[model samples]
Target: MALITKTDLYFTDYSWSAIEPDDPRVTGEPDSTLLNRKEGYEILYFINKLSDIWSLKNKSSATKIERMIRFEVPSNIHSQLTIRIWIHDNWNESRY
Candidate 1:
């Protein structure tokens, strides 16, 4: 259900963007294993705001959440696919 839209990082210099090397849902390379099997269920949709009209267009949730996957099996595709977003900290990773 995530239509491949991404842009949210207040950045202290974090950068990585590599897509289209025969992209089949990026089957394992960037941080180990990612292939949303023929395409589905890689949902990373986030929205946030503390309210009091601090409007990020009015979202009152999502401190942090993440997911990623994009794929195409057929159809005359031009803009292929990719949406790798995985940074949800899981208690700061002790194999959470």
Candidate 2:
């Protein structure tokens, strides 16, 4: 007899919140600053997970990232979504 294993992939729906200028999270902050730092942090965390699942490196190419996104997200969501890649000077060293 031999042991066997199975794996499956699942996609979850995501929603973005509307940010107001008067919101305490961004109130009095410069326009150049992050509008939604929490959201940005979550996105970065998700991207890292994708990279791990796809055996990708931290500096993986944009095309590779796109492919991973396409593979993990449903077609309908991907089609209607817009993705932005932010590359900070210290991205590799930053915790978030």
Candidate 3:
């Protein structure tokens, strides 16, 4: 596999201009107002399995990162729920 950079994980704000330019909500919209206008996102549970994948014998070859996320949303909501995971990458840092 290839290296994972910061830009690969970056998510931009939602824009209504592309979908509906004539909509009143899209006119002179603030940065916050343009983001996630319809969907609701919540993180119910997040787990990082670092120790399970880390091995002393294969430390040099163990470069992959594994993540598991679980979300439980109620059926009453009309719109779909969204979830995002933010990761900070520090090349100089030794700690994983």
RMSD of each: 13.8, 15.8, 14.3
Q: Score residue 32 of candidate 1 by CA lDDT.
A: 28
Model 3, residue 24: distance off in Å is 2.7
Q: Which is better, 1 or 3, measured by lDDT?
A: 1
Instruction: Evaluate all candidate structures by whole-model CA lDDT and list the values in order.
Output: 0.26, 0.33, 0.22
lDDT of 2 by residue, 1-96 (tens): 101111111222333456564554333312233322224323333444334434554443323343344443333332111222332222344332
TM-score to native of every candidate shown: 0.22, 0.27, 0.16
Colliding residue pairs in candidate 1 = none
lDDT of 1 by residue, 1-96 (tens): 222233442222323354554554332233323433232222222212111112333111222222111222222322212212222223243231
User: Which regions of candidate 3 are displaced past 4 Å?
Assistant: 1-9, 12-18, 29-96
The CA lDDT at 37 in model 2 is: 22
Q: Of models 1 and 2, which has the larger TM-score?
A: 2
Best by TM-score: 2
How far in Å is the alpha carbon of 83 misplaced in model 1? 16
Clashing pairs in 3: none
Better of 2 and 3 by lDDT: 2
